[model samples]
Target: MKLDKELVRDVLLAVEAHDEPDRWLAIKIPGKSDIEVSYHIMLLAEAGMLKADDVGSHDGFEWVPTRLTYKGHEFLETVRDPEIWRRTKEGAEKAGIAGLGMLVELGKAYGKQLLKERLGIDLP
Candidate 1:
């Protein structure tokens, strides 16, 4: 399954919305199959963004994301705002920046620029 950054961001947002850590949450994005969602969840877990447990057989397993890590929260904060996410993705694509970490860094930079512009506060 191909990884979709938008879907991954949406999944993180969904997970963040729910505060319960012990409960199992099912991510249901329209037009996305269970396997695809599970694959993204696995990727997020591998990236250390979330904690997930694999359940079921090796051939057909389900990924149950338990909770978001501190890194996940930071990443989400970078991309949570719609304008920041759009600008960050566009800038990253233009600069050929790959990898989630790099994108998040770019987003943080853009966020700082936006803050500086809005509040006239110098951010280093």
Candidate 2:
């Protein structure tokens, strides 16, 4: 399965939105298949974005998301802004940069731009 940026964002948001810190989250996105969501959840855990438990069974793979790691929070913060996320995706597509590393870099660049424009706090 291809990397779905939108789904990645949604999963991150869902993890972040879970209010109960101590309980495991059941992240279900409407219209998204269980496997697809499950795959991305695994990817996030592998990428150090989320702290989760790998509960792979005979049926298939699954995870119980606990919370976001520091890296996860950093990336989420960068892409949480709609405009920044939009610009990051657009720029990535235009430049043919599909890797998550590039996406995060692009997002950070746009996030810095947003801070400069909105709060006049320039970042080097």
Candidate 3:
């Protein structure tokens, strides 16, 4: 299945929200159900937004660690500007409210509840 921009954005959001950076710093995204997240990471990698490196093996399975490339960090900085989000939403006619809602939901269990709370966003 092809990965979409929404999922990719979610992945980046999730990563940046990690307080235990060590947890994700050298770990491949977990759960087989999240293949699309991995696929999105691959696309980001190709776009030079992410870099994948082999960390080690797990039960005979090769584990790859993904980290934000410089470009990814830059993108994150840009998106943090509410103006960019506002303009993007306006130009694309996308549901920014719904998108932010979904992101908050993902952040709930992904170690970002404090940040979400500080931002006055509720997560599912």
TM match of model 2 to true structure:
0.90
Off by over 4 Å in 2: none
lDDT per prediction? 0.84, 0.88, 0.51
Highest TM-score: give the candidate number: 2
Residue 74 of model 2, lDDT score: 97
Better of 1 and 2 by lDDT: 2
Candidate 3 lDDT (Cα, 0 to 1): 0.51
Highest-lDDT candidate: 2
Residues 21-104 of candidate 2: C-alpha lDDT, one tens digit per residue: 677888899888877888888888888898888787997778878888899899999998999999999998899887777888
Candidate 1: regions farther than 4 A off: none
lDDT of 2 at 120: 98
lDDT per residue (tens digit) for residues 12-34 in model 1: 98889877987888889898888
Instruction: Give the per-residue lDDT digits (tens) of candidate 3, residues 22-115.
Output: 4444334455344455556556666666665433346432323246767766666655545444444443444443333343333333324444
lDDT at position 48, candidate 2: 89
